[model samples]
Target chain A: MKILITLLASIFLFSGFALAETPEQKGLAIAKEDDKRDNGFQDFTANMVMLLKNRQGEESTRHIRNKTLEVEGDGDKSISIFDRPRDVKGTALLNFTHKVGTDDQWLYLPALKRVKRISSANKSGSFMGSEFAYEDVTSQEVEKYSYKWIRDEDYDGEKCFVFERYPVYKNSGYTRQVVWLDQKEYKILKIEFYDRKNASLKTLTQSKFKQYLDKYWYPEEMYMKNHQTGKSTLLTWTNYKFKNGLKDKDFNKNSLKRAR
Target chain B: MPFIKPHRAGWTLLFFLAILALFRFPVKVFAHEISGFAAGEARLFPNEALFPGQNDQSASFALQPEYYHEFESGSSFTFVPFLRVDSGDQERTHFDIRELTYLWLQEDYELRVGVRKVFWGTTEILHLVDIINQNDQVENIDTEDKLGQPMVNVSFYRDWGTIDVFMMPFFRERTFQGTGGRLRFATPIDDDRVQYESSAEEWHTDWAMRYSHTFGDLDIGLSQFIGTNREPTLLNGTDSNGSAIKIPRYEQIKQTSIDASYVVGEWLWKLESLYRTGQGNENYFAWTGGFEYTFTGVFDSAMDFGVVGEWMYDTREERATNAFENDIATGLRLAVNDAASTEALFGWVQDLDTSARFLFLEASRRFGDNWLLTAELRAFIHQPMEDLFFDLRDDEIMQMELAYYF
Candidate 1:
């Protein structure tokens, strides 16, 4: 009779969570689920346009073509080819991101036909005169940060799970980031970045999330605004296609020269 | 593009850039596109000219039009023809086919034919392994410009690395400053009276091979070249007019070189070494090793500061024609990381044996989307009489180039 009663009680317990669950555990679980939804995307390419606005609302534009190759056990490899500002045309940047070690970046100068190995320490600096830092555009791996559950809230009329995460990379410019992810699709909707001094620096809002292959979700636009400088950058992605059969060879340093 | 006056041509190019900047730019990049730059340059010397007819200041104008096309059949063609018109020196005002090449790309290998420029080195202050194209020294004293060489090349990419083989048919001779140029030597090189060690002369076929690999944070390259030397041995001779001139004699030589760089976060270690057998009395080995460390996001600002220090050494002491044979170079690099992409480099090279020093500064900043301003200064100080650069003792040059790209 006692064993029967114990079995009945166990059946009433929660299936996805333990009887005693911490906020950290819930946050980690949410991140893992969010990451799991983005799996199986072998490759992707997109044409991106960036509009940068300053304090007086003066604006400039930049055009870039980018490609990404997903790695099964590690972070993704990416390449960006600059197309605008005519002087920098044919210039390319190749990046290799690792989940737990050093990342590598190489810059190809078209004028000299030379490949230069650049330090990844530029993560804290602005990317192409935009409000977005290099770290902000890098591949988001769950292992790169530690998280804690904050609460559930309605962000812009969408049901979101708010969480706070701290970057594990030593060279990261942000002290912490507050993220809001939609609970249904597990897609990140917003991020608030805090500077090294724990001051609010920038806010990034992602919108127009589109689903591809019935499993992957990508934001069509991302807007980042710096609070201190009153400058903003809006990234609009077009012609985004996934599963393009891009290989590892496409992301090497040598391939950058021919990435036209 | 050629034989145009300096100031008027510069104004015309600026107007062209403005009109092009106003229009909706290019949409046919995949198929083909036309892009290049036009510039107005002024070179001023602080000291008196060394030669009789040389002037303290020179004005020049340059224009380059490049056309690139890639077809769906895995074949591509590139054409870049450059022209410059100068008000002072005739040799400095010339035309060049920078690159006119056809490329056939395949999965494992690619083939290229025609005139092209190829660079191979890892050192910053000095390039020891870069021996493919002949230097266009009249364009700049730093040897950054090159006269393209006619070659047939095939490159193969494998799991280990990449291998490139070349068969160069015609060699280009190096260009030197003329008597009217402010930076000319005591006696200018007579290109018309040039000599060659081989009977085949400039038509001698050259062979070269290179293997380059990147593993983790390390990038390495090994190359071998068997050909006529690029740096000519200036023999004291006379020109066709029987005037005192230096006859440039090209020699057949062989060289093997290795260049490698190991990057560790903000610190990059670089080395370039070479072994050559022909040119001088005996065979020699030369090398340059250095490290560059950068401090990014300096003091919470969007700026980067880089410190560079290198040691250059050569086995042949007095016989070495290179001024940096036994020298140390230190430089500072600064980048604003701003929208304009402003950057500056300050370098100083000191001879170990003598107290001679070479100081130079190069800075550039973009004014708008298409206009760029570049300024450079070079000063030679404390030179000994026996130094190779003693000819540059009284020459201090300041140069400015305003370029418009489209």
Candidate 2:
């Protein structure tokens, strides 16, 4: 009887230790769930307009065509081709994001008729003089960050799972990012970026959520406000198409010159 | 002859207008539209002309329009015409078919025909492997502008790499500044007295092949060319007026080049090397290697400071035609990632073997949405009499330009 009691007690203790979830585990689980829900979007194309606002309230607009392809077991591949602003017309940027390492990027200059591979060290730098950093424009993979569940909150009249994510890559400009994901659809509603000093720097909010193909949820509008600079950027997306049968050849370096 | 003489300029204007009208008509019928930019440049200096009958100031304007139409068969036709008008230098005024090509894209191969420009190199200060297009020297000395070349190009893309083959049917002569133009040699080049090593002269057929690939953090390109050399050898001759002049002699040559770039963090290492023969029955090698490091968000501002250092070398140091042998070029690039897209660059190239140096500064910024304002200054200092560009030692000039894009 004494031996049996000891064995039962040990089994109970081991099961308790295995089932109890820590904050880190809970955060990772939430992120994995969210990522799993967004799978099966093989490829997509969308048109976007970037509206930049200066400190004095002056505004400028840029039109771009964006295409993204999903890679199994890795980060997505993306390409952005500028169509408006005649000076920058025919310019294209191709990106290949990696799950655990730095992303690769290339920019094609039409005037020079060459493709230049750019360094990814300055991921924190502004992208095309906009509030969005180079890192922000990249597709976020689950392995890019380490997450910790903060608390549940109400955002825009919907229940959200609040989490703080620390970047896993080196030389990232932000110390941490606080994100609010809708509990039902696992859609990102808001994100707050903290600088390297852990000071609040910018806030990005998304609205007009739309479901495409009855499975993927995407926001039609995104706004980023720089609190310290009194500047902002608005990205409005339209003409979203999915599963267009885009092949791997469409996202390579050669495609940059032929993006138009 | 009288009717044509009276309407020469007007006819040119009408011809361009008619081309624009043709391009505009397709925009309404096709899904894609045509676009272009118009720019004007003015240059001034405080010193007298380096040569007699030259001006210390000049003005020029340029118009570049592009049109592309895609067909249902996945083939496309592209047309780009460039026209420049200069009030100071007659040779600088020219027209070019920058690109008039038909491109057919296949699953693993692509073919392009007609006139186009192709660039190949990794160095910032010197482009040793970029030989597909002829240099438009009358426009600028920077070698950034090119006159298009007519060729039939085929490119094969595979998992191994990309292989490109070019069949160039015609050779284009490099344009030179006239006697009345600024930055000219001691004597003008008599174009009429030009000679070619090939019996076919400008009709010589040239061929080239290139293989390029990118793996991980490194990009590499290897190319071979057998054709009329882009760099000409000056042969002393007498003009029709019985005055001594330099005649550009084009020679058939074989060249092999390699270019590579490696990116690590914020630093980029670039190298370009070439080996050429069949010029004056001599063989030589030239190379340029450099590194660029950028510091982002300098001084807590939204600015980037990039420093570049390049070393140029040639087997025939003093006798090199490019004048870049045994030289070092260092430059600074400043970028303010602001709404105006402001950028400034300062560069200095000094000959290691001679007391020759060149300094250049350029800054530009956009105004509103369509206008761009640019300022540039170029100065030469302490040039030896035997230096290639010594004749233009006193041609320090500052220029400003305003460009409107649509």
Docking outcome class, model 1: medium
Model 2 misplacement above 4 A: A1-15, B1-30
> Model 1 misses residue A139 by how many Å?
1.5
Runs with alpha carbons beyond 4 Å of true place in candidate 1:
A5-17, B1-30, B240-242
lDDT of 1 by residue, B1-406 (tens): 4432243223323433353355443344358888999999998998987678887899999998889887764467787878888888878887777777777777778888777888887778888889998888889878778886778899999999999999987778888887888666788778777899999998899999999999988999999999999989889987668888899999999999999999887789999999999986789999999999888778677687899999999898767878888999999999886677789999999999999999999999887678889999999999888888888888899999999988
Classified by CAPRI criteria, candidate 2 counts as medium
Clashing pairs in 1: none
TM-score of structure candidate 1 = 0.93
Worst 10 residues of 1 chain A by lDDT: A11-20
lDDT of 2 at B329: 98
User: For candidate 2, what is the recovered fraction of reference interface contacts?
Assistant: 0.64
In candidate 1, chain A reaches a TM of 0.94
In order, the candidates keep a fraction of the true contacts of 0.56, 0.64
What are the Cα lDDT values of the candidates?
A: 0.85, 0.86
> What does candidate 2 score on TM?
0.94
What C-alpha lDDT does candidate 2 achieve relative to the native structure?
0.86
